[model samples]
Target: MERKHKRLATRRAAGVAGVVFAVLTAAAITLVRTALPGGGDDVTLDAGQRGGLRTALELVPFAGIAFLWFMGALREQGGRAEDRFVATVFLGSGVVFVATLFGAAAAAGTVLGDGTQDSTFGSHFAYALLTTYAMRMAAVFIIATSTIGRRLGALPRPLVAIGYLAGLTLLVAGSGVPWSEMVFPAWALLLSLNILWGRPPAAAPRTAPA
Candidate 1:
């Protein structure tokens, strides 16, 4: 009973951490899209605003990566599958996400503020967008795919469904809306549900491992 309680406590902590980081990830996405200057009035960002956006945007991907790593770790510790394939995809995309953010930050250092922008400036901006937001989107794709292939339980059914729905919605439509930023938080909510309160493991049979 005590061991079970301790396991539950650990899952709770991991869920909380995942939620916190997911919110951070969402906020950072908002910052990148809305705070930066450039593009049309629809997406305009000034030079200084871009700098600030660059700094904030750089941190978000890492937070998300950490969030995944934490959840995977927790699942492993709790005697879940650990799903090496999922972990590998998560790790690869996460690295690209984080590395690109820092790259943007580095770019911010050299590029001084100005009202107008250069064409090459657009290239760097594109890089940031592709690496950070684009790859985050990819993470959603991977998660959705794995969820479909995995063996899930009844109580957790809604979570997997929500994840698939939200991920697909974001992949298709979320990027267009100004408030598309909320997608990360939605994902975080699903992940937390799966981690903290998903179906309990069935009793182990008396037979030993084959």
Candidate 2:
């Protein structure tokens, strides 16, 4: 394999690791929820289960940070935003989006476990998770942008555009929801696309540090 191919493979591995960690975190949360010791009928959730779920969900942001670190590697190897214009736009938006997620996570994490019926740090974390999830939609942008002007040229630009628009629509929907739970299935699909079927873009040219 060529050197560029090697780099893409490496980056793909890091991304897949990030995705796998995130999915496992979600699985832990779900399992904790289901394992709540409740009888057959509709039941009150146990504090332990709720805390376990929160604890599991809390780990997810770190997974996202790890994924961003992988993306950072891709960017470090001279991944230029302008390489794919639409993707560049989304990436720029993603920079701000993830930054917000980090901030929100930090703020809520500082006051962890302080729950109120009105709005708790837990509630804020839920919102932050959904916002982070909206950030997940960026992968569609990443793949589409990265694939453009390449062999996938036959694929319509509008389709990618619409997919992103639709993702944005979903992002705006269902606020106050901790959607990190919901996106894992879709995240798995995206991860597979990157892993099983990616056509690595050309390695970005090396640059002199300013």
Q: Which number leads on TM-score?
A: 1
Among all candidates shown, the one with the greatest lDDT? 1
Clashing pairs for model 1 are 36-45, 37-45, 37-46, 38-45
Candidate 1 off by > 4 Å: 1-6, 37-65, 77-87, 90-112, 115-150, 173-181, 193-210
* Model 2 lDDT tens row, 55-171: 654765765566565455434333442355654664665565456545544543333333343334444454444445544554444444335423234224554454455455455
By summed lDDT, the worst window of 10 consecutive residues in model 2 runs over: 35-44
Alpha carbon lDDT at 176, candidate 2 = 37
TM-score to native of every candidate shown = 0.63, 0.54
Show pairs that collide, candidate 2.
none
Candidate 2 regions exceeding 4 Å error are 21-45, 73-88, 107-168, 176-181, 184-188, 197-210
